[model samples]
Target: MGDYTDKVKTKMEDLIENEKNQWIDLALKIHENPELSFEEHKATQWLTEPLEQAGFRVKRHLLPELPTSFFAEWTGTKAGPTIAFIAEYDALAELGHACGHNIIGTSAVSAAVSLKKALDDDLPGKLVVIGTPAEEEGGGKILLVENGWFDDIDAVMMFHPRDKTMIFRGSLACVDVDITFMGKAAHAAANPDQGISALDAMLHSFLAIKQLLPSLPASANVHGIIRKGGDATNIIPDHCEASFLMRAKTREELHSIKRRVYDAVRHSTKAIGASCTMEEGLIYAERINNRVLGYQLMYNLERIGVEVDSSEITTGIGSSDIGNVSQLVPTIHPYIKIGNAITHTPAFTEATKSPEGMAGLIQAAKALALTAFDLFQSPSLIMQAKEELRQTINQRRNRL
Candidate 1:
């Protein structure tokens, strides 16, 4: 926007450009060896090695409970805001980096290093790259937020690789439920009267859920798979289990849907002479984008010759652990266009390692670094973003 901002942004561009190949190589290494959620030991090591080597204070296994999660901090000479870039490296099961998380994780680290290098360590705030694993299966960032990992962060930023480029896309609130049904087992023909079939109870629950979905809001959904319907058709099943992933527009709506679904499950279990237990994983809150930060990122992307689609998306939304982090602090999870391939697909996996994907990675790193520079240069921006977050939280509470 001004001479000083332009000068600093130029430095960042040069720094990130000079080492683009290294970042791409790092991302490709992670993509080649995909790791599942909470089991990203190699990805974690590869992502953090550069930070550790760059003189940043790197902490491995940040929380003992989360083995793959780590934190790297670079503080300036003067006191100011703490801007954090979130890195999600966990790949989908069997899909292997279809979501382009290798790009997300690498871009965060590259941005932090370039920003620090561009400033020559004479900046006015702290730069942090948080290695948050398990966005695929487990809510690693949600757990980190619960454990006070994001308590002092003034702002959070991350870029996702998608078919489209968007700055203010919203995500649904979600949670996973593990349903277990227990009943007495007996031979199908030999002791038919003595058998209490858990499989029947599970089937009844599924039917009830299917019937209930039609009555619920279009934004609310309950889908699941029967993990163990029965060991054999000849025997009455004593134990059965199912896993369902539920989603809603907001946490309040999600809670209501959960209540109805759980009621149906219990009612179905009772009708079939079986007992059931429902274990819920972490509840991922809906994302609340800070307009102030979002605008800064959008402006940075535009300045760097990257196009950002600022349109509103009301449907085809998926949930993320970043949603939970957004509830706690001001956060931005914008998307950078890598290719026209849908995520979580084999085509998307190939796109993550494509030349276009590498270009997107460099663009993401520069935008993130530039945005952080702007915040450090102007303390008032941090205050404005935080105020917006406060208002957003209050509005959500009032709605609930």
Candidate 2:
């Protein structure tokens, strides 16, 4: 390795040793005080305090609509590329960090801070730590990218805690929709013929969706919940609310399946003499990974004694807001193992606070820090990442 590379590796090792306890403490604190999507006030405060103290100019982007999402930037003297370290801190509803976002938030903060310190003198670029909220619901990063937050960013990095470590595993395209059914209400025993039950409409819609399953592709998924049914047993329901999530491998495929779903909802409600309304919610695009950056990160992880299995790299059905960011910039959202627990469950919560969890955080921080150093030190890698991203986006647009 070159002298500059050696220096960065040395500094990363020292930073990991010095900030290990601090990171663990922060992770545990965030885990203990879990906050839901778009309400991560405590998490935002916890992450930004350290950045401000480290002499970085912190700016809060408060949208009149979205209060919890924000971005912080730290610039170095030498002019080069801007690298963003994305952090997510939203907890699942009632699950309380079951997805291990506490580790994600702390690991990102640790990586950004270590990178900042490593390049404090004679640095070549800028370091940005972006606190993204509501990955569980709102897709906050999608809004940020839409508003041009990532316009100048060259590369983005973040790690999620999973059962194993691997390179870029592509994610599915997803759309969340809220469906409401309205009908006339009357006494079930006295005027049953005069009542149009909204619950009956919902049942028809569910049955239609069940039949659609056989026609859907292997990559397609449809899931939903009936949020509201009725008030009492003797009264015909006047209104019913249901929410659904649709997923597919590509946006085109997602759109195709979504049309069938909408038709199902419309026909079912029409047959029951009930009107229906559909409201769009979070829509996540599929992740487009930068292969050049993926290989570079894999190399850095191996240098740090993290063995990543190639056979483990596969497409994931779950979606993320990071997918939105990847569409705009070159990005990598690699997963590092905490333990063998299934994510989004109580067992995952326990594993996230374990000793193994702390170790995984440190390892991820080191790998991310090293990868950032490589981007700053080696211009070729950064150029290749950008070029790959440009080509991928162009190809996708052409297909569209």
Candidate 3:
């Protein structure tokens, strides 16, 4: 640690404490007025307001395809690495802020501001606050990466509110598949032989998927919902639609499992005399938790009196768009413990507004600032992270 370490950390704490209320208000306000994925206009405005005011050059709606997405950046002092704090503000359907993105987005903004305020002209590198929306459904960060948004970033960090805090927890690679079946429509009583039943084809596909499930690896998941069954009870359905999500520890595993699942759907549709069309979303790759970068966050969180989860890591964690970002560069998606409730629940929504949630937000902000400070202070940290990512890629390649 450098001599300025303590000074920088103290500055972060002081600045965060000084403006704690304003950040808390931001989180609570977002929680009160939740916005769904790809529809976070108000959230974009609220989240970018402080960053723009802090002398950061703000760019709104960076993805014209996603009007809610934005990013703010600041470069200070000497040339060095560019570190980003990812912000997710999209809410869940009906559940509203049950996922605690309100806290995630505001804490990121507060952390960037604290770092800028503390370092001022002494700041060693570029600072960025990336406004990523639609995490709940559309995979906004995934789209951003596709458009070269993360090309210049050195290290990316974000803290999620969870029941347990893990520094290097993993996530699955996942994809959404929509399957549609088409068949001839006819009056059931008058022309039973003239109809090809789309419902029957869909049911056959479901059965085939169920049969294929046991053949899949234990790490993989295949689940789906039937979106459209039939329009009328007496008529042979002309069309049917269903959606399924496939997940595995990594993209390699997901690819194999996805192939089998789709094969089953195709063969099933053919057996039932129906044609099918399938639409697949972007693949959210498994999270590569850069061990080197994770340590910075773990140390900072521990220093702040938060018990970091150091257990032998468990698999089967849910997927995130951050997982997609992780594949591109060194990243850390640390979890901050807020309450006992798991995410995507009414209780979790309440926790996001509770005192405990506010405390977690402050601690998370400080951790983010301190970790960024450590990275800027030591260029070798970035090298180590990049090397770790390189090794991970080689290992994954060999496995594949």
TM-score for each of the candidates: 0.96, 0.93, 0.97
Residue runs of model 3 more than 4 Å from their true location after superposition: none
Model 1 scores a TM of: 0.96
Tell me the whole-model lDDT of each prediction, alpha carbons only.
0.92, 0.87, 0.91
- Per-residue alpha-carbon lDDT of candidate 1 for residues 105-157, written as tens digits (9 for 90 to 100): 99999999888888987889889999998898878898899999999999999
Q: Which residue ranges in model 2 land beyond 4 Å of their true spot?
A: 397-400
* Candidate 3 lDDT tens digits, 1-400: 5667897798788899889999999999999999999889899999998998898999998878789988899999799999999999998887888989999999999999989988887877899999998898888999999999999999999999988888878888999999899999999999979999999999999999999989898898999999999999999998999999999988999999999998999899999899999999999998888999998888888888889985546464789899888988899998889989989888998898899999999989999988999999998999999999999999989976
Candidate 2 per-residue lDDT, tens place, 331-362, comes to: 99998888899899999989889998889889
- Distance from true location, Cα of 178 in model 1, Å: 1.4
Q: After superposition, how far is residue 98 of candidate 1 from its true place, in Å?
A: 1.5
lDDT of 3: 0.91
Lowest lDDT 10-residue stretch of candidate 3 = 309-318
Which regions of candidate 1 are displaced past 4 Å?
none
Deviation in angstroms for 178 in model 3? Answer: 1.3
Q: Clashing residue pairs in candidate 2, if any?
A: none
